[model samples]
Target: MAKTASDSVSLTRQAYALTDDLMTPNAAVYWIDLLVSAALMWGGFLLAATTSSLAIGLVAGLISVLALYRGLSFIHELTHIRDDEAPGFRVGWNVLVGVPLMTPSLMYEGVHNVHHVKDRFGTALDPEYLPLSRYTPLSLAGFLFVALLAPIGVLIRSAVLTPLSFLVPPLRRFVKQRLSALVINPDFVREDMARVRPAWLFQDIACWLWSWAVIAATVAGWLPLRFVLTGLAIFSLATFVNQARTLVAHHWDNDGGKMSLDEQFLDSVNVPPPNLASELWAPVGLRYHALHHLLPKLPYHNLGKAHARLAQALTPDSLYHRASQKGLFEALTALFRRVAVKPVVAEHGRHAAE
Candidate 1:
């Protein structure tokens, strides 16, 4: 039999107990992963510079793109974990991935917390969500089309707005509330900025300073224009891949309404039997998104173990099973089919009524 709400609660608690040992973040593993990802990114960039061969450069650039994408994904983990738990992880991420990409941790931290709120997961208030299920095919196309230009948007914010905002306090406030956040909802706005956190201000300034430094170096011929352009291209392509991955991360079915824990889990997605592709696209614990939603406080490193525990504890008919798909392609196809068939089903029902 399918588990009731109470049963789900009991099972969730049990699953949490089973995975308790894995909840703590491992500093050594975290540092090693970050360093390796950095090496792949910069190594590829240097290789691109040394080679005049377009094919070789392209291959190397793609490697950097994948590495940068995975590196940026660590920001998701940063948002969920506490400062004390992973003391220098955030700083390391900011130096390596955040500032260079112009996606500071401040852009995600508080904004992502709202996404996990039980009442806000699928609503307009959820910064990370959009009602993609109701979108027409053309609208969906436009969504992805806009995402392709996200790197340009980030550049404009960092290169143009960041410096200007410092001189103009009002503009700084505007940028802080509107431009600073990394959110998907078009209508969502962050209003709180009266007393900015010291860490956020420092990260913002660091990004601003780095952005100007890069610009100066490139203009002065200290940094090769070719290398700068190559880096920008890699960033753009990586962000595009991230956007594509985001599209299939959820069912995107909920309207502007509150969802229970079960409904929320069902509305989310998980790509099970995690493989190379899943890890590359949804790296650093993203493949277990549904499970993360179930236990938001659980560390990213522990998500896979928690997933296994839950799979063992829950039956096939559980809501958890319904939320998971075999792979990214399958999930995207399911989303597309859901949108495609809705109109046909409605039309058939109208004919039947007539």
Candidate 2:
């Protein structure tokens, strides 16, 4: 008899629990990720300056940029603090840790969870839905264009659409506190915008103030504006790479067919935890994606263990092959061409590489 979905989850969870049910992380690992990322960021900036070359600085900036995402993912896991926890503690932790990384605590918490739901749960209605149609082949030029332009796209998506979404009355009740008071209410402003969460409000203010501080310091000769811009560019590029990576991971071979949440997670490939490459361009939790989707609340350290646990239960042939390190450029080339095509087969939802 074939096992059902519930049986699968139960078995997987049992295996997961057997390894280490301890959900929360050790204090040392937490601080180490934090300190190491920070030190590398500042160190990268210093290295950029000492080299007196924007190219070197650009490389340094990329390292720090990856570090930022790793830090953000860590904070993301932390933001999963249970509702029973003191609201003040949750909010405070989000603001202090999240503000520095420019992660919108309130927004990420909501959207990320939504992003995890099964693709078939909603139609185009799903925010995190990966439309199977995106698998169409693209010219090599178009693929490269998409990959290269990724960072700019992320900035526009996050800095604009995200803040504007607060206009919705229901969403505003949760996100409005993060909006600027001076923001002109659109003609059809919802009345509920008045109730802002103090923590989100303060954090938004802090982010703006921090950006201003950087701009000011750059202008005042405390930090080179070019280096700062390079950092921002690299940060933006990292985000774009993350999106491109996801495109390859999720949409490939998705032929307008339904896939279960667990199936989808199984199909989405994780980039191996990077070494030299990791220092320069962070993987954006790509290494732990399967773990992330499986248990959204677990901090990243547990991701490897989760991946290992799930390894046993997973159908061997189901594992998605990721682009290898040496073939990174080649993978990008093939990915841009949408080489991961699903055959027009007899099965309703199964995918196979062509």
Candidate 3:
């Protein structure tokens, strides 16, 4: 049964009431998880770099992807974290994971929250949204293919664009507004017009120096070229894994229109238990993504507990239950199966008109 507007309101209220106690961000959990993930990622990358055996390198490479993917996923949590709740964690994450990965928190912090806005959710204006189901299957493949190039793209952005932008004020403004954000929507423009922010400026400078150092060291023969290439390969794999996970994150059913809260929740998905692989692919509590949409402020550590609470309280036929998915494959399959040719014709017509 389709959930009525009142039922959505009731569900939203119940969600907040059931998980209000879980709202407090646990700094200890944040620090420990970040540190452990960093260690595993670095350790795995080092092992892969040093190992001679192909099998050992492959295993180590996989570990690096999973570890780094988990660590980088913290960027999402950092955005949702209250300002006073996890003090210094943002800087710590930038230093430990973000800048190193070439995906600093600033790239996502100002951008992601917009995706959750009532009017923006699933709309073309939403930086993180795209109507995938409305497109051809070829578009889906193109999306994944583009994700493969992300590491190389960001490396160039930091190494070349960072210094070049400094020399060109107009370019600086352009970079901050367009290139700085991590968004899926090509047309989304950043609203930031301020001259300076110490936080993002710090990350930009750090990444600039680090990116140049890596390139210079590799070119000057100070860093082994093979090792650098291996690391890039591993990073690319991690990125591709994330892109695959994203393909099933939501239904991508909405056109360019405002949606009610219930409408947005139904469009999103949650791959809870019996889908343990989600723990690795959708790390940092992303498996409960739809639920996260409801409790935006809920810490990642408590997402599972909050999910269980809501599940036990809500009925089987409730919107909460309907939001859940069995696994990633099922969700992706469902999304692609709904694709239509009429949307393709409309899309081409729109492009031709332009």
Candidate 4:
């Protein structure tokens, strides 16, 4: 980041101060919401996989997918939180949502922090970023379709490669560097695993064992093929939905350069209240992506209130108001408009969605 980038954080100070008190994450809120979402996910998944009626199965499957998506979205919160602040929440989340879904918190834990750095926020180094708006419409179509591969990719990573990598140290290193992160940028290699070895070993072993158990159960006829297939389909659908939300999470307007904190905030997006659809699509305070850029430490439960306070306190010309989108459709329409016309001359780091 440019030295000026650090100097200009004065622009964000008010937002930070306004939301200072909101940083305390409510433990009760996290526990209740997480457990309820898990229960709904498992219950709906069972009905969807085993029910006799096709219509009922389809409806239950959709609900299950949405619930699972919401549960998985908590990984974002996990990434921001310190273990001292919210003791045991991360472990509970992994046991309930991450391991079962094949997207253990390890996939995102040590990786997402880089995206928040001013120098890296929208540049090639940002693992969570992809310059999607500059891509051709056809390429964007492929982007959505390709996200469906997430389930198979995770299964291979956890089940097949984990054990093989353990046997071959070089393969283990390669896997850790290349495939360990839940990143959009495939080239983003992880270098921080040594810092997280204990947690990594725990989650990695659990995921490996769970994957093998599922496979063994299917092979031994202890678990129905239909149920396993249905679960994959549901997880794949959830991945697709997340990718769709990701498309609107940011404007993707940067051109692979170090940006000021203010520039990074504008580059992001926010789909705030009265937009009920946003709650379904961008769960877990993600709807406030831009506000999040401003107050990244604010807990998910407190994001809405923080946003309202800023909206009322800040003037109409403030950056906070500009970050707010009316709803999902409006935000998506803006993205579609950007992609509708392929840029005549794309620059370095401007490519198809990751």
Candidate 5:
């Protein structure tokens, strides 16, 4: 007999129940890691500005971009973290990364929860999902290309759209529905603009104020143009790396149908044997994405241990094994190859019809 969704859920619950002790968040570790990430980002900017050597600056910038990418990834954790577990971490993150980058935590807070909803995953309602595998190679390219321009788009939203939206209710509604989301699926529409939460409102205002302040400072010669440009460059590069990671984060093969809990896990991706590359590229527990869908409340720091426990508890034939990929490169190549072969398959089908 085949294992059913209930069986998968039962197995996962059993696996996690054994690792229950690991779920507690270590406040000290979280703070130290976040502080170090911020230092790396700002330290890169300082190195780039103070150093005359282009090579040195480039190396420092690359390091900073990688660190910033990891730092920003903590936003995903914020959505899942309980306030009692890590007090003030969310506000600190907003001040350190969100306000400066124009990607406030509020944008992802309520939004990402939808992706984890059992019935919503891979559907139009899931903000974080899209059916990329069904599209042509050209469409895939377009998707990534748009992602490359995300930094600029974020800046525009903060500097231009954010303030304008506040003044005009219609524009605010439009922005809330179309722009405020941290989503990949274009079809995911947010219809809850009128019921804005206080935290979201506060974060949005902070982002707006910080964005214009940066612009004003740059224009008034208070902040150097080169510094501003360099910061934007780092943000752009980091966001691009994130976009690339998002591309291969899953199989992206779902066709807008509701999936069972087991099917949802199968649809997600997990890069096991966590190494340096996985740590850097898919930081903040993203490498265990499929497992995350299974156990949403598990803190990021504990994901590794959770994986270990689950791997040992589950049999070799578990659906967990199906979601594991060798590494980032292999996963991306698989996606690309899938897109490339899609056209050929469609052509063959057309000829068969003739």
Candidate 6:
């Protein structure tokens, strides 16, 4: 009886270990992500320092930005982990791979998870909503203006106003629930602006530390400002493009109720550029967004395989046709042509009935 009980306990332990591995992202993929991101940042710095050429710096910066995007996508997976689970491991993983690129993974994941929850996520709830307001220009020139200024707009909405929301008690409460480590599925936003969540102070410290490190390095002449600035510019552009893609995937003719996890995947198009060799260039793992959204835990390398499985399981209508590398520009043009005329509706959620 003693031997039998011991065997049973060992079996149980083994099973638990197996389950943990399956639930977590594969180790190989995680390592690959780290290597890719490090390579991009280090490579960009190296090239920038050696040549002082803006073009080289831009290319290198773009590569690092793309890597950062992929790294953040992995964080999205950890956010979905059950509240009972401590996400510190995942949080640490993100900071290790993502901070150098200006994407604070924990803060972004906290906010983005709210954007995913069907109940509270919509134009009304998400501050990132960029509807064609009067602030939006009406002419072709206006479209260009908004697109060019997209980064500035995002900074105002996410970096500035989001933190400012903390000033209001009610608003602070709502945002806090969503961000609180103790609560799962907390109210992401309050309909009334008075109840926003306070800005996460830890995230602020992280951003400050990252910025200071970069600045100090440049100031020490360990790196050139021209290279650093050029890289930052390229990264900013890539971040804007990724944001635009999200707006397209989730915004467009915003019928918030009509949106779904499946539909977002369908509507979200991937544009692979002609420079296949440049996979490291503008947001790694983006070509597999549908897969990333569906199986957030999967690492970048496995995303394509997951997508293949998803494609096989779902119907044709469930998937939107993807834009090719050469077709991304044309696709953007078409999207802009109708942006004003098309109302940005909410995703399929509580508002879907309307």
Candidate 2 RMSD to the correct structure: 7.8
| TM-score against truth, every candidate | 0.92, 0.64, 0.95, 0.93, 0.93, 0.59
Candidate 3, residues 312-347, lDDT tens digits: the string is 998888889888889888877777777744265233
Question: How would you order the candidates by TM-score, starting with the best?
Answer: 3, 4, 5, 1, 2, 6
- Tell me the tens digit of each residue's lDDT in model 5 across 1-354: 576988777867786787789878897778898999999988987898668999999999988898889889999998888887888898898898888888988778778988888778777677887777766777677677666677788889988998998899899888888888899876667766569688888888888888889989989999888888888788888877788889878887776677777778788898978555888888888889888887888888888989988888777887777889889889888998897765322211111100
- Which pairs clash in the backbone of model 1? none
TM-score of 3: 0.95
Candidate 1 residue spans exceeding 4 A from truth: 1-4, 343-354
Task: Quote the lDDT for 152 in model 1.
Answer: 82
The alpha-carbon deviation from the true structure for residue 251 of candidate 6, after best TM-score superposition, in angstroms, is 5.3
After superposition, which runs of candidate 6 have C-alpha atoms over 4 Å from their true positions? 1-24, 52-65, 68-78, 81-97, 121-123, 126-203, 210-224, 255-284, 290-300, 313-327, 340-354
Clashes of each: 0, 1, 0, 0, 0, 19
Q: If both were scored by lDDT, which would come out higher, candidate 1 or candidate 4?
A: 4
Task: Tell me model 4's lDDT, rounded to 2 decimals.
Answer: 0.84
CA lDDT, candidate 1, residue 268: 76
Output the TM-score of candidate 6: 0.59
Off by over 4 Å in 2: 1-7, 20-22, 53-59, 81-101, 118-123, 132-195, 216-223, 252-262, 271-285, 309-354
Instruction: At residue 179, give the lDDT of candidate 2.
Output: 32
RMSD of each: 4.6, 7.8, 2.3, 3.3, 4.1, 11.0
When 3 and 4 are scored with TM-score, the better candidate is 3
lDDT per residue, candidate 4, 1-354, as tens digits?
A: 233454337647877778888889888899889999899899999999999999999999999999999999999999898877777899999999999877889889779888887678887788987777787676777777888989999999989999898899899888888988988776688988755478778898899999999999999999999999999999999999989888888888765666777678877888887887899889999898998887778899999999888888877766667677787767778787887875722322453323
